[model samples]
Target: MPKNSDITPLPASGPQNKPASAASVAMPADSHSEGGAPTSEIELPDFNDVELNNLISGVKLYLQEHNFTEFSESNLFLMLIHALRTAINTSNDLAVQNICKILINLNEIDHAGFMSLLSKKIDIAPYTGQSFAFTLVDQFYSATITRDTPSLISLNFLFSILLQSDSLFLKQLAELQASGNSEGMFGLLLIAQALLRSSTESLHIMSSELIASLVILILKKNEELINTRLFQPIPHAAFSGQSVLTFLLNVVKCEAQHSNEFNNLLLKQLIEAIHNAPESLVNEGLVRVIKRGPDEGLNAGHIFLQALIASVQIKNNKGVADLQVLLKTLSARAGFNAMLLDNITSGKYMNQSGMSMLVQALMAAKDNEYDLTPIMDVFAQIIAEQGKEKVLSALQQRVKYSSTTYLQLLTNVAKDDSSMTRLLNLLENESSHQETLNPAVNGFFSKTKSEKEAPEEEHKEFTSTHSSSASH
Candidate 1:
């Protein structure tokens, strides 16, 4: 919240003194005298001088006191532009840096208006405009490394402007990535990280685009950069508490218009995180990502199922439990049942052990009161396609080594008398089925049999009643 004046001014002569003659630059045509005659050009100060800084300060003060619309047409804008051009031509880093501060202040006053005007002005000279932008980027990198918040905010504003206005800026960034410039790459990551962490609304809007672009660029050049740098924990204390993973997930959540290539990169990263990171981080991260619902280009449900399968494959109980939390959300989506059926029936998850894990997950979802109709439908489809015998045989094998959760799931999926009888007969064939089965499993089987027989009993009674009526 510090004002621009808080920054230490550059060592220069008093504001009352004009720049030396050699440092003077021509004013724009609009700045001519009242009679339409050319006036003396303004004195563009040296890097060490304060005249340009004073002019910028004057503009800042005027903007603070009056409407920015008034300043757009004012004489001060033309003078500031001429001075800015001179600084750009001379590559006077100091003056340009101060101008960045002024731009940041103007942006604070009216973000959209000032940015539009700035973009228009920069478009006048593409090459010089890019040069000016690059200077700001360099300054931004410098401020980033030094943890200069004020300057970072200012320079980042300019950087965002460049991103919005110049297409080549991104190309240059890709070039930087391709060249193996670690410093450049890291700076981009840090800037992006900083932008996401920023509380500013405009910064938030630009940050998503910035992150998407950087991720796409990194994904294209080397995915390893994402793992090593972008995903690495930020060293700054301010960002120490933030998660880059969550930021990326937010991008997925908030911006759905990204190309499939971008969405694929994000999905890949999430899957990698789930597979490699600690169980806690993976579990929590997946829940949030799945809740955000990544773009349809990549199936969030598939991602969830993959993580669920991995958790089961490794016997990570915590992972499985965490994923069960998302069952309802994933199940609510259309075609989710079909997707789950395909995944559980075809991949590594299709095996006895994998199916057992999925069964347990579904059973837990049922116990939690999450609607398992979709999952039950999947189970039915599996039985119909893969044969009830094959499905029963797999569950029978898993029941021997795992918990009775599979038995509970079997009870739910075996909706018909024949399917229930087949599963019970399979369990009965096990010599130790009685001793090994928990009360829950036994209860599930007993309840399933009675429920299946009730309708048959009612039909038999109806038949007897009709016969009695006819005899009468």
Candidate 2:
């Protein structure tokens, strides 16, 4: 939250962006099992109706006994989810509405807690209605972008669980259908529209909101605005006049049909945010993407590389720096570093400045350090493209002013059998000799000569000793 105002309002859109009707976005298919778990079993305990009834009744009694003092929203969050699942099964519209009312009440009592829990596990189904659902989503966006970490965390978890639970439910239905229950097919068809998608479509709206909140936070000048509590709106040239969530929802939904297009657009938006947004916010978001690991469906590393490559192509200095930070932050990640050699060198994304800065950053990073393989590849490519004189000059400059680590790495690259052979030839051809590079070269290339001379030197001593013995 900026110091101006901690409140941001996410305005409602027309019928096109309706939350319950998220079927428009065409989310990826559900391949996993129930509750979004990969297996058939759900993570949550299986509660029969009687047990659910007792639990709900117990909660009601507890609340009544305490004179309706609202319990901790976090504590009641899972309880509400359990109750709502029962409500979904009962198919009683009134019960669903009542559950919705409790959620709203929780929000009213503790907006932070409700927003936190809503961000985490609260589910609003048919009861909230399409319009109401959109409003709730808007509120979610507003609450999330405030940069309140606790609230944002809850909100983030909310959208994720929305997809997971809906996926799980769909998987269960799929398994049931596979079981060959033709008799119930007609009944399922009637409710299929409501049951099939569940909250997935709404989750896109949430995704849109999440992106918007981040954009808002990024547009603020104060780097530490997230930790502040002032209220601020989305004001930036990048966003134009429209708010973050609304625009992204509209654009992403329209482009949903195009597979990589959507992902590309998403990546572009994140890079844009990183260039203009708060470092902390951009960093936190990138870390999450990187942490998602490289899976087949969506690869965070690929997304990161795309961003870095774009930054280099456009010569966005800040963007490149942010990317460097990203790599350094995740440097120790073997999987990420394993791909850096190809990610950086395979494409001509880095010019002289970009490549040099990247190499220096990787070699110089204090945290999340990377191995020499990627570092070696970077300088090797630089030497090949920019010539040995250019790389040697850079190394000489680093040794002159900065640390020797850069100098040492450059020497290591030059000393490699693959790189050294060419580098030595290039230097010999150009006749550009540096005194600093001499001893390192002598130290490295002398290994074979030293090995070959050891036996001869020993033999000479043995022959001398034998001749002296014979004379004696």
Candidate 3:
């Protein structure tokens, strides 16, 4: 083994020559005394070597001594250079293990120079090369600015390195994902941040590949990390530059069925990113990243509707209105109204607790003054298209759609002082008018139960009639 010039008497790997504590070695080189070796006589490994364990403590001490100033950079780099070389020269299990231990221990320190050196030396095969590469990337990420500009630039070099190593990096990332190794996947995200940094135009040029890679990450790998706060900044970064945002928007607009949780989270984040995103991202080309699963088929339209509903629930008035318009565009483009009618009439979401969530969002959207007329128009159009039978079927499936609630809702609609008058008017139209709108309404009002002793069937019939009438 090579000597570490800066420090003499480095600790060696494997078992110690003597017991390091009062505990006896279970199997000794020779038969031991029945009781054990004398406690005082048992020698331990050198205290400093054993306590510091590896290069991590030394690197940390150096940073501490320098008050963590830029002047310490060169000295740290020198130490890391030697360590990287030593590990490379040894190139065996012990060396790899030692290097990993050191890197893990140094996780908290700002040691970009060391990370860069390690990244360069990590190309060696049969040594868990990808894990080491990602470790270096992770350290680089840790070194980045959490709240300032200068650090972002300093860390941008790491992005350059990641961009250069994309394929190898992605392959290793996939392996880590398959192995269910979250730490390794976290490192991959440090690399992914680079892709989000590309110019809007550049992203546009490579939108297909970018989206494909994002989908794979969200759907096929590292789900736990995909849902984390760390993943939140990516969409904003991806939309920072105009050219890239436009390109991304166009790509998303063109792709209709991105069905993955990661993509879902990304879509949610993209909606958030719109607040500060370049106009190109919000307006350029087509921008519906929220999509349906394969199982949804025609039923997939509800997914976007749910997303729209969620968007409207935002507390900010401007945001709610903006989203309402955005949703209108999306619904018109994707024909979501028909799907919603199908799900509601089929009672597909009747038992799903998220139905309540939808109601809550709708109530929230109701508070916004953005002429909900268009939204109501879409709702009416859907009913018109699906026929009253489907609409009534959907309402019957929803336990919340009782005759009492519809009556009260009608009363409230008649009393509202807001801009939802048109929707309210539609709902208050007479039973006969509703019949012209949908056959379900016609069938519904045709039956009547006794005043005080209405049969269960009669109650359902009465409720359906009121619900249909309320929508007229």
Candidate 4:
């Protein structure tokens, strides 16, 4: 048993957000086939009612008595693990639900105690008899939406515990789901969600490879039960001031850079889910994806951005009447839209494609107020990688869309002494000997060329249209 000194109560306040409700958000009513299979011929094993009831009663009694310290005893823990194992071996839903209820009750009654037990370094090899770890995980999944605790905090804590489970536990969860066991898929998601709650820098190091494997298993088995259940709650939780977006950002980032094709498939399914999903989820999912892999969902990102920007447009399309589209616009107006512009300019996502997306997004942004530092950083990186000339030529076309942007960029460069010196040196060297202008330097003339080369009739036609539009 843990000594009394080691059993301190966890600080009562967590996340400080409202508790997540199981029934608070409504999902699409259709029940997808278990394992998302084309036919329901597959029969998964049912639960053992007697064993499950005993396990639940034991766990609940332990929680109620504040006797988790007893679990610290090697022999007691082994017995508990055995019971949990037997409970999962059964295919009975009520038995599974009862076990879940015990876990949820433990969380509500003694969160600190639960976290303490999870943090204990038990020798998991001997404990792996029937994947007791998976059963414990299933307990968490069953309680996720049903438990009453601070919004993402309790969920985040649950995720942390799952991530620390033995690899065998994770492996078993993956195997069960792969074998078309719908219930086992729940355990996989619990692990996935926990990984999402870890720090971004630490996340890639801790769970990238493992998460890749799990995501692959989910996709290969086409486990819609897990996806529909877990993913559906994200937006609702996020919209109600939860940080599901932040969590997803970590998860998506880990998935994005993996070389595995499974990661790619997961990314694809994730995007489709975003398109048809509710507004809050779409926004949360998009933000996370963009934060991690801005280039992954090119078309979806474009549509999402357009949808976000469209909301801010003075003249919106009457045909697009979805509340999500409307909310995206309103969110844009309230500075939520600024996140796109901010990410683009943040330099955190600097790459050829990232810069390309930034330019495209900026063009779409029109007169939207956004910082240019990220773009400037991107410009510097592009010039360094692709050379100055290519970057300048590209900028030249973009500058015509906004002289204000051009001046701001030039002003930013001039203000930085090192960058200014380089600019002066480049200009001087080119001006000294070149008969033809360098591409980078020629950005100043790009717009001029279009104006000078325009045919008289076409120019007049363009001017007339501008004048007419201006008059209106």
Better of 3 and 4 by TM-score: 3
Q: What lDDT does candidate 1 reach at residue 458?
A: 33
Q: Which candidate has the highest TM-score of all? A: 3
- lDDT of predicted model 2: 0.33
Q: What lDDT score is found at residue 220 in candidate 4?
A: 39
> What is candidate 4's lDDT per residue for 276-379, written digit by digit as tens?
45566444433443222323322223333333233222223221223233333323321233333332332233322223333433322232333333333434
Clashes of 4: 10
Tens digits of per-residue lDDT for model 2 on 50-138? Answer: 54454455445445443222343112334445445554445433444455555655544555433333322211232121122222333
TM-score to native of every candidate shown: 0.31, 0.27, 0.37, 0.33
lDDT tens digits, residues 166-227, model 1? 34444343222211123233344444444334312324344334444544443433333344
- What is the Cα-based TM-score of model 4? 0.33
Per-residue accuracy of model 3 over 349-405 as CA lDDT, tens digit each: 433222222333344455533345656655566556655444444443333444332
TM-score, candidate 3, is 0.37
Worst lDDT run of 10 residues, candidate 3, spans: 1-10
Best by lDDT: 1
